[model samples]
Target: MKQTDFVEVKQMQVKCVLCDQIEDIDDDALQAKRLRNRKLNMYLCTPCNERIAKNTKKRHKSGNFHLFKEKKDTNDYL
Candidate 1:
């Protein structure tokens, strides 16, 4: 990529974990900071987030939205 003249501020490049879309976000944003600090933090685009929210709402209204929790192994240490 060629360096443009209006390249003063730095942009944080992030990829959506689900959609794999590359986007540029403000480096000073809170989300960017969280992503940089946490390894498990995932970044989702606006459309993907909206779609998940809509589907979750629909499932909740249907009374079949069950959040399955992971089974933790019990420790045997005395």
Candidate 2:
């Protein structure tokens, strides 16, 4: 397998807090969630994922949102 494919396989281990099921998430999705947590100490529950999305959207709309800096690109040299 290609190196990119290997990295993709490695990061698909995020589990749902409510159901205890591992989600088939790509690296981008996982990074987005982690970025949200870094900005706000928000944790995700399966039942509350939508709520979290709505709340963050509201916070953004109200100008009370926390924002994380973009991650450094891992493909710099290549």
Candidate 3:
């Protein structure tokens, strides 16, 4: 008997968390920031880069945060 290595990837299928316009993404840029040795990937559309700024503002003002949880999807782009 042989054992095979299984790789599980979780993806989110929501409209780009940044733009909130593009229902989907083509070739977007993913940047990873390190926090406590954990890397967090941030997804954004070229035009919607400003959304990140806006998000920061909301976090600063209301102390509220929105996170995009990963779901299982085959259309994930690395």
Which pairs clash inside model 3? 11-71
- Give the better candidate number (1 or 3) by lDDT: 1
Q: Count the backbone clashes (under 3 Å) in each candidate.
A: 0, 0, 1
lDDT of 2 by residue, 1-78 (tens): 888766633344555665675655555675546744676343355566887789888888656322322223334434
Give one digit per residue, the lDDT tens place, for model 1 in 1-78: 557866767789989988999989999888898998995399988799899899988987665423322112223332
- Measured by TM-score, how close is model 2 to the native structure? 0.32
In candidate 2, which residue ranges exceed 4 Å CA deviation? 1-11, 30-47, 51-78
Best by TM-score: 1
Question: Which of candidates 1 and 2 is the stronger one according to lDDT?
Answer: 1
RMSD of each: 9.0, 15.1, 19.5
Per-model TM-score on C-alpha atoms: 0.58, 0.32, 0.25
What is the model-wide C-alpha lDDT for candidate 3? 0.45
Off by over 4 Å in 1: 1-7, 60-78
* Clashes by residue pair, model 1: none
Model 3 misplacement above 4 A: 1-38, 64-78
In order of TM-score, best first, we have 1, 2, 3
